[model samples]
Target: MSQLCNVLIVEADSKNVETTVPLLRKMNSKVSYVKQGLNVVTHLQKKGFDLVLLADKLPDEDGFRVLRRIREKAELKNIPVLMMLSEDESKKAAFESGASDYIVKPYMPYELVARVTPYISLVLDRQKFTDECQRKDKIAKQLDEAFTEMEIMSRLDPLTRVYNRRAFLEKITDEQIRSRRSQKKFTLLLANIIKCRHYNERHGYECGDFIIKKTAELIHGSLRERDLTARWSGDKFMILLPETESDGLEIIQTKINKVFQESSFEFKGMNHRIDLSFSSKVCTGNDDLDLVLKEIE
Candidate 1:
């Protein structure tokens, strides 16, 4: 109430209603009144309130029943419900029934104001902090998702869904550092389509693009999970086999060759077997990546 707050005041009698409503209004709170238990439930369902000043008695139902119902609701259960204790009502019973705070009353205005004010302020502050955290979490999740998508688009070839040339170059640099630290070697294999231009001329660029994409898929599927493959150029591809030696390279080459022999590109009615030429080099940790790539050229 000292800070801004919304409070629901449930009072049945005319005298108590008059006293309680004005007392809450003087504190500059957004106050709502419900003279019955059902109306209390209705107002709470339809709106958000920081605090509820529930009278100990309602015309239609016991105030404790209303309090229990509010507590049962998932959404409304957290709002601080202060019970207005009459002379006959037991404060212990009210507390046991989940009353957040209680005030004994023959309408002592100052005591009423003092008791209700702090609870309203505290609940509002807690709600404000909760809302702010939820907003920040949503924004963080959106940012994380956006960054993930941007990273994928940057690192991968859009057409073939393979690692792009730039991504490959960056990875090889990291691999070079790792190899140097470990004193282990890795192999680089570059493969080029022999007559990709002729295939494009014979069919269309779309057909040639299909061939490229399918070849990339085959090469990627042929390798171990640890091996990295990239689309180096329009008609060229490269592979990095980590912690590999000459024997490993030879074995990988045989697998790829077998895959190539079994694979064929079919357009319309004609089937064409694409030919690939491969060159490989073993890096001893210090070989310049640019110079090493030049060997395959």
Candidate 2:
């Protein structure tokens, strides 16, 4: 009742069909006998068989042609195909036509059963494996996206979408690992607002918040794709630059100071000047992220 052993047999000779039918039935298979290749497709669509057995030579078409048609039909492409080849069959043609398995004529029922059973089981197993693989791939992709989102939420500065303190440390750890293995350069910056606390006390919390967010924006916008910025904490920030040596850190420090110097934010409809005191340490020979961050701090 489960219909698991369902099969469609398409042997052109009535004698071959006669010889094969009882074997298939003995194996608990449902069988259909066809003597012409022309009818295979229609029968294939109607029966929706799990397996197909064919004689290489046919009245209307060859086994290869039927195989081609089977492949062309999207619904039948995955159905397993077995062909009965002659003693001098074309090995190349049979293989190229996508014949799943081949048996020479004058074959024994026990031998036929032996080869065909594994192939059927293989097709079923492959289908099951392929289905499971696709399902897992889809699930893995979804989970990767979700994990990235959660990481962004947890470790990014909200206003500027830069890495925050936790993210900064994680990135630093990654850089340190990379540097230890290779001769690569890494850099870090410890920056603090000169009078950000004063800005809060005198101008109110809202004004202070605007000042912090504005400073964060300038730093975030200045970074290249390879660079990372983080909200180190309130009134503090850290930056990590990969492939930047000691010389590069100097240029980067100058850039940071210049950006802060030229940029001004308004509080209570009045322009408020901001100042940043920042330090940079580049990972060169014998430099560690923790040590470099401490130097900048």
Candidate 3:
């Protein structure tokens, strides 16, 4: 492979270490040497190795015990471990103890490299597949977030930062259905900015936009947390107070009116007052939605 593979050699014999290191390095591999079986797991935990060349005997512990220890660890369990055995050592025992493969001692250099090649290739392929899956998942998550933001932007009035006409209509329709099922009443208040067209003509469109935004802010600030406010159309706003009676409607309307009357806007060295005409309807599920909308308009 083009990528350098990491091979950990768990051998205490200095001759064996000297013989094995150069052969593996010729094939573009980085090798880590640990003398004892006790250090194998610690070394493996610290670095990611593609293949582990475990000696049948170690200075401190048996190779089979080391293999079993690697298998016991959740993170180290899947790493390919090739056991190097003497002529008399049991190859069956190597496999049973979780060796991916085994090499008989006094082996040819080419034989050792040949046996180790396939496992390294397998590990590199698996890593590539895992990296691809993670990349795709990140892209999918970003796409989902982008779509969510687009949906939110579609529902909001860009000028006022409130629900637009289409969004307000959908919300009121759903609320109507809910009110019907619960047998509850809701208050729908529509406010028309009196002589807004004249104001726009007298001043500029920027000043007109400022007045609309200011009116929306005052009305929204005056309402309870549960209330929904929307910019229904040009120079018109709508409010939905859920499960509210006429008494509640009167209280909210008075609060809104008081806020509007107290508020003033400055434009080009002039103070301007906003005048709005309000119409309200107490609606149940039984009310014809189209008729109610027409009446409010």
Candidate 4:
């Protein structure tokens, strides 16, 4: 009784409306009225109601038809519907048409309130449960998105926006297993920026960082989509070319050398040319991963 309730009275009778509206209002219920059964669904769609007071007789259509229509709608189907009937009207027909309960016409105020009160309480409880579930679902979705973003950020190098050393090691390990199973050779290349320390001391650390970032971009752009590149150390990068042999390695090495030789970085109004030193090893998955890393590094 304390919780606010919305009730729709689908009755054409003035006497019934006068009696029912005032009594329900006294009980803290907000009431709406529609004289035609055709308007029942329209009203419910516009402003949802907790309970419906449907008279079997309406000006436009039978009240049973309106109840069935309400039951058909996905949004309004679960609302409690109380069918108001004349003494001679068949209660059996109302129940079959999906009435939650029925009341005889010319009834006492107490009886009407008694039948309508329980449904109001039930609806309010149901609404509260639904709202809580939807809230939890929204929170769960937001948490899932946040966790996914954190996982991606953890795998990436902040400056160059490529895989960091730890993530690259995991990827290369998996690729090694796959290549072994297929008996295919894959190439690993380690690259170092020539005279990187000299540039950092002469120009500044900012210029060195720019050179590193630009080199990562050039190497990433020159490789095939399947190739993986990672920032291995301060001025060193590692590349994994899956299912590649000596010819593939040579082609990639030449391409990377050409791009590096052609590209230049502008620092303090001066264009500084950059160069790289490369070492490569091809493995058929039988090589010790630690030894291979040591030899290349």
Q: Count of backbone clashes for each model?
A: 0, 1, 0, 0
- Best-to-worst TM-score order: 3, 4, 1, 2
lDDT tens per residue, model 4, 1-297 = 145679999999999999999988876678888888986798998997888999999888889898999999999888889999976456999999999899999899999989987877676676677788888998999999999988988998999999999999999999989987999999999989999998799989999898899989999999999999999999999999999989999999999999988888787898988799999899878889999999999
Query: Tens digit of lDDT per residue, candidate 1, span 191-237?
Result: 88889998799898988998898889889999999999999999999
Higher-TM-score candidate among 2 and 3? 3
lDDT of 3 by residue, 1-297 (tens): 245779999988888889999988887688888888987888899898888999988888799999999999999999889999975457989999999999988778888989987987776677678878988999999999999999999999999999998999898999999999999999899988998987789888988998899989988999999899999999999999999989999999999888888889898888999988999999998899899989988
Best-to-worst order by lDDT is 4, 3, 1, 2
Question: How would you encode candidate 2's per-residue C-alpha lDDT over 1-297 as one tens digit per residue?
Answer: 122456787776788788888888776577877888897889889977888887788887788888888888888887788878865456567768887877888789997899678755665576677778988999999999999998778877776577778777878888877877787878777778888888788878888888888878887777777888888878988888888878787787788788888977666779987788877776753666566666787
lDDT value, residue 84 of candidate 1 = 89
For lDDT, candidate 1 versus 4, the one ahead is 4
Q: lDDT (0-100) at residue 141 of candidate 2?
A: 96
lDDT of each: 0.87, 0.79, 0.89, 0.90
TM-score of each: 0.64, 0.49, 0.79, 0.77
**Residue 228 local lDDT, model 3:** 93
Residue 34 in model 3: shift from native, Å? 2.2
Q: How many clashing pairs in candidate 3?
A: 0
Model 3 lDDT at residue 284 = 97
Quick one: best TM-score, which candidate?
3
